[model samples]
Target chain A: MRSAFEWVDALPSSIALRESLNAYPTLLTTHVVSMCLFAGLIAFWDMRLVGLTLRKVPVSNIPTRLFPWALTGYGINLITGGLLLYSQPMRYYDNFYFWAKMALMAVAGFNMLWFHYATYKSVQAWDQGREIPMSARLAGVVSLVLWAGVVVTGRMMAYAGLMPEWWNNLNIGA
Target chain B: MTQSFFEWMQGLSFSAWMLEETWASPIIQCMHLLALVAFAGAVLVVDMRLLGRGLIKTSTARLARELDRWMIWSFVALFVTGAPQVLSTALKQYYSPFFWWKMQIIVIGLVFTFTIRRRVAFAEEGTLGHWPKVVGVLSIGIWTSVSVWARLIGLLS
Candidate 1:
């Protein structure tokens, strides 16, 4: 593994990306912009689910129509994220925090997909402006909890990054 | 279960700190911010609904429950991406009161949520009463504080 690091460290492209400011930062900027786009739409939909604003808008219409653009934020994030990873692969291989972030993202993605099928699948039946069902409401509650958890864990990821030599030191812990 | 796991993982290696420099770090940070928008927007919608802000004639239960989905999703997003960050800087934030405070607020907020659900389990469409309104306020306060502190975690680090 150490030898692999040496090889990786010596790679021409990695060296260039590591040295250049343009590669990662440019992508980082996009990541920020995309996030704004995505978060803005999702927040609106979530609020609708909570019955806060746009009461005139059907519950189903908010997520259904607004989702397309909000989802674009996720796509932008993925594209920008992939580029950054390509620039330096090994930094996160042994880094548990990085892996944890990946794990949370996986869960978030799975949850959203599950939600699309589980909650929204039959939504049209009761989405007639004001007669939304109890089941759908309960699903909304569950969805809110899960989403908040994802956000907290994501921030905690940044906090966790302060650890410097944890993985190798505790490779035998479990 | 998720909360417990986060605590247990705190004792890992110091090397976990590299997350601040990773290629995907910035992207995740952006997502973290995005989670706030989603959660806040969701919660505010709930609050306004409870206070008769929106969905004036909609069932409080349905609106509240529907909002639940976004809240859960937001948290999930934060956790999945945030854990790595915690592992990286465990020691720095381990004793930080903001960390503990965030947890406490979450617990309180959750309890309020449960109580609201319990009392209004069979509730039909109408404006929420005083208690649920208080809970709604608490929810907004605690969650907003949590977000603010979370941002602080980044700055302090």
Candidate 2:
């Protein structure tokens, strides 16, 4: 596993990104732009689901409306995030904050699944001008919390120095 | 001059405390982010509706009226939290080009939001012609700049 990490870290693309002064900053800023779209829309939809906002709007309409924007944002993040990892594979591989972000994302994924399979099946009945089932509300709350956790941990990876000290070879070019 | 103002702000007791406390910065950062999510989310939804791309099956006027309160509230929250955060690092941000850029865009964004976007939202549906579409597209572009530049402030600093 360590050898595979080292190999990717040593890849030419990774080396190029690491060497370029503008590459990381540009990528980081783009990642943030995606976050404003992805997480921002998700937060809005989740709030509506939880009956905190857009109370007059039907619940079923939100997913259909916001899904595309959300998907675009998510897609951009996936590309940018992959490049970011490529640039510093070992640093992320050993970072506790990265693992925490992964864990939170998994939880959010499961919550989304449960909402679709279980709660969303009956969305039409309670979709408009009605109280959302506590179960669905729970899912919404969970999604919001977990996504916020992902953002916080993602930011802390830099400031908190949550990167592992033992993850040497961060600079493959060096 | 701006230098003396920033220097005075940096000497404030509140600013000193905010700087000294390890958790204050992060907590304030969280508040700033939450406000961003709320403000941007509400704004984007309305903009999508104005652009005729949203699932909101209501009249544009009604949708705008309904969302206006939440948007205003979030904007207030953003300003309240953002002011102190900037003031806490006044000296540093005074010289940071990104900081100035972010501030300029933020003011421009506020004007666009209140003037053009608000007008189009309340305009009669079919009567709007091409101006609403222009405002809708511009709103999205301008807000994107606001969010991007706002996030870049920390990165550049």
Candidate 3:
């Protein structure tokens, strides 16, 4: 795994992206901006599922209407995030927070799949009702928590030094 | 006068603590980002409706009213978390052009969101013709600029 990352790190594109004066920040800004579109929409959808807000809007319409925009935001993040990782593979590979974010994202993905396949299959029966099923509501709560964790860990990646001495010592870069 | 104010803020005990405690700044920043997510979500809900995209079944006025609380509260959270971050490093922020630009854009965004955007959002649907769409686009652009300028504050200098 480490050798594979090293091979990618040595690539010209990765080095250029890492070394460029403007490209890195531009990518980062785009990533952050896109989050407003992606995560922002997802937050609303989750809230709706949990019966927090948007109760009047039919459950069926919410996902059908918002998923396209949310997916656009997700697509932007995937590309930018990929390039960011490509730019500094080893830096993220050694960072604990990076792995934490990846793990949270994986769990969040699984939660989405569960909601869509299992819970959402019966959404029609309760689409307009105020009372959401416990399973769907639980999925909403889990997703919200997981995504929040992803954001926290993602932000913390920059402050790796703030981690405990043991964690810092584990960093190969350190 | 502004420089003295910033200097005074930097001299405060709380500011000193924020600067001295390594965890304080990051924690506050994380709070700011979290607030950004909430606030942006609230804003997008309304703006997307205005653009004739999401929540098509619900009235735009109703959607705006429903999400208004989220927008206001989350913005307040953002402001509360953001102030300490600037206070901790007032002098450096005072010198950063990106910082000033972000502040100016934030002010513009707040004003635009409340006045023109709000009027358009809460206006009767289909009556405003293309105005809602225009306002929606402008609102998104303004808010997006706020995020961009905010990021540039740390990235540029």
True contacts kept of each: 0.16, 0.51, 0.79
Candidate 2, A1-174: lDDT as tens digits: 668879998999899998888888889888877887788889988988888878888888888888899889989988998899889888777677777898998889899998999899999889886689999888989999999998888776675443445543463223
Which one wins by lDDT: 1 or 2?
2
Q: Is the docking of candidate 2 incorrect, acceptable, medium or high quality?
A: medium
lDDT of 3 by residue, A58-169 (tens): 9999788989999999999989988899998988877888988999999999999989999999989999889999999999999999998988888998985766677777
For model 2 the local lDDT of residue B120 reads: 86
- Candidate 2 chain B: worst 10 consecutive residues by lDDT? B147-156
Candidate with more favorable, higher DockQ: 1 or 3:
3
Measured against the true two-chain complex, the DockQ scores of the candidates, in the order shown, are: 0.10, 0.59, 0.85
Could you tell me every candidate's TM-score relative to the true structure? 0.47, 0.91, 0.97
Each prediction's interface RMSD? 7.3, 1.7, 0.7
How many angstroms is residue A72 displaced in model 2 relative to the true structure, after the best TM-score fit? 0.8
Model 2 Cα lDDT, one tens digit per residue, B8-104: 9988999989988876877677777777777777877888887788755877787788778878998899888888887798988888888888789
Tell me which of candidates 2 and 3 scores higher on TM-score.
3
TM-score of model 2 (CA atoms): 0.91
**For model 1, what is the C-alpha lDDT against the true structure?**
0.60
lDDT of 1 by residue, B1-64 (tens): 6555555666555335444356455566656666657665566656655555544455666656
